[model samples]
Target: MRNYLIAGIAMAATFATTPAFAKDVIVQMKNQGAAGAMVFEPAFIQAMPGDTVKFVPTDKSHSAQTIAAMLPAGVAPVIGKPNQEMSIKVDKPGIYGIECKPHTSMGMVALIQVGKGPSANLGAARTVKLPPLAAKRMTPLLAKAR
Candidate 1:
């Protein structure tokens, strides 16, 4: 009986200490022939809190910054330098607005929705002041949020 209890305790301890594998989503910044240099492949993503979003620069001079007003109440800020590969760990359940600072007017933007459904402030996020192009692009994407 004592050995069985010890074994059970050890098993529980092992599981508790194991680090959970995080799911990673890749967003590539590049230029299209006519579309110009403004977009994230797989522009719309649904990730769980704790998932990592990797913004890879395939073209030169692109940065990823999360608009503070676009995130949920408790989400930490995410800002990446231009032309660098930035990795963000999302631990908040809401909509995240990402944009390339330099190309925002040209419509380089993407959205990441964390959690299973639409966030509480979805309508407000859709109305945030964004660049003309970015705003236009998000209109349709926001409608498709789960």
Candidate 2:
């Protein structure tokens, strides 16, 4: 009976001390064909600690690389080629920046903000805001080129 009681206590302790794995978020990189540049859609992402962020490439020639020391400790993203997916598990709460090696100057960049809550701000501030152009007037002009 004593052995059974001890076993039960051990099992309960194990269950209580186990850590939970992080959840995954998906991010995609796209190529718009304007140039040989990698573009990250939505540019900014937010998550909590222990969350995993997966980077998916939609461009054939682009890859992702995490900026060293940009992220919190233990939060380094896996970087790879196009059509390949990599993930970063955020253990600490902070902002992280990722960029494509081939097109870092062409704006192939993204940012992830991880924290205890959903209040952390990630990504660089937008510097330019173009006025909304009339799509109806622009469509005919663009169509003529095609």
Candidate 3:
């Protein structure tokens, strides 16, 4: 009986930790040095609710911030500075637009599509139109391959 109880407890622990090990996608925000504006690689990412998304900075003076009212309540990310990383565990099914505060006007915005419902296209289907300035700066960055 003692051995059986121990085995059961172990199994329970494993089950409890299984969900926490789900795969995470690491997205990068490129700083572009001084040639151009920073840009998020892929420009858009698709993730399931509960999945973790890590934003890594690839240049200096760059940061990630979720535009107010762009994400559902409780889904906003905690903004951080360059070289620093920020993570968000998407818990709701919807589209989110994230940008670098100072660069948004220069097209430093990207999209995050969470959960499986409706369209999943990050740009064409659920476009988060950016300001002309922001879009212009992002043009060059978007052309480079990851």
Candidate 4:
């Protein structure tokens, strides 16, 4: 019983100091989803740094790419081909805006929040002038960052 207690304490300490495991989050691009037509299901994603976001094309003619003005500082731009799967690892803390190039006018967009820290580029992201429909869709997503 004494040996078991020591082992348990050691294990508890080990786990307490261990870093959180990175997670893989999936965002599906669909022509028709819970949100209606031309949408990325669960359009808003909250994640921590080091997590990976996988964009899966569930319908034809759907693609994923970063809105240059919404990109985080020091991070490379991500562009995904239509009907293809693309994965992006979140290494910095900020807000990232993703859109389906061909369908952006129809409001196919997604927002990724990496880390809980306030985004330094949120203002820049808000300044990007998207098409009417896309801007309307992004309004609420950006509101979540605050």
Candidate 5:
């Protein structure tokens, strides 16, 4: 009985120390959504650090990737192949700019905010020049950032 109790306590401790609090937020890539054609179903996402953002390709010929100029300092870029599902684990608190490479000119872009606090890189990300259509689409999404 004592051995069983010790093992149960050990298991509880291990579970408590693990990163089980992280959750996955799914964003679907759609050819046509409420926003229009070639867009992520939810163009704006709010998540916490360590949370995973899963980009599901619900439509063909679409991809999800981070924009170079929109990343937080020291964070590596995350990119997905066209028509493939991709997941990004947001490890930092900031605004991450995502785009469908082929459709960016037509405004296929989205923004993910990792934390609730104001992001230090928000201003810079907003200023990163995008195609005319992407710029117009990003304006409202950026405004949704904390």
Candidate 6:
């Protein structure tokens, strides 16, 4: 019984010292009728693994989706429907590219950086194709990490 009690205390200590709990980050997809006005607020975000990202559409006609080609090899794809709240749990450490399908041409894209250090597949992520404006907008955002 004494051994079991000690083991219980050790386990409890382990949990207590660990990084608390996961958090949720919100991303808003805003729509503006004017060309180039539709975009994602805070186009770049840094998060930890196991965090949740909730994509909210703050205006008419917008959707958030993962850019498949830009995701880490093993990560799952996410595609959010218009005007609906979509939540995604991030379990990988890497950069994730998000886009608003209808507005991608107008630079409606975002990026999420999870965890620390570097991900194994960053090379693959850079290969993703984006619209002219999207690519232009992401250039500085991506460079900020370096």
Each prediction's whole-model lDDT (CA): 0.83, 0.58, 0.65, 0.90, 0.92, 0.80
What is the TM-score ranking, best to worst? 5, 4, 6, 1, 3, 2
Better candidate by TM-score, 1 or 3: 1
* TM-score of candidate 6 against the unseen true structure: 0.83
| TM-score of candidate 5 on Cα atoms, chains taken together | 0.87
In Å, residue 87's CA in model 1 sits off its true spot by: 1.3
Two-way TM-score contest, 5 vs 6, winner: 5
Cα miss at 97, model 3 (Å)? 1.0
Worst 10 residues of 4 by lDDT: 14-23
The 10-residue segment with the lowest total lDDT in model 6: 31-40
Model 1: residue 26 alpha-carbon error in angstroms: 0.7
TM-score of candidate 1 on Cα atoms, chains taken together: 0.82
User: What TM-score fits each model?
Assistant: 0.82, 0.58, 0.64, 0.85, 0.87, 0.83
Flag regions of model 3 displaced more than 4 Å: 1-21, 33-36, 73-77, 119-130, 135-146
- Candidate 2 wrongly placed segments (more than 4 Å): 1-21, 33-37, 73-78, 116-146
Model 1: per-residue Cα lDDT over 1-146, one tens digit each: 99999999999998755537558999898875334557888778889877899999988988888878888887787899989998888887789888888888988888889888758868778889987888987777788775
Q: State the lDDT at 36 in candidate 2.
A: 34
Give the candidate number with the greatest lDDT. 5
Clash pairs, candidate 4, are: none
- Estimate the Cα RMSD of every predicted model relative to the unseen true structure: 3.5, 10.8, 6.6, 4.4, 4.2, 3.4
Residue-level lDDT of model 3, residues 1-146, one tens digit each, is: 99999999999999865656556888777766333556777576777777877878776666787765456555555676756777777767666667877677766776677766553333332333568876554443333312
Best by TM-score: 5
Candidate 2 residue pairs in clash (backbone atoms < 3 Å):
none
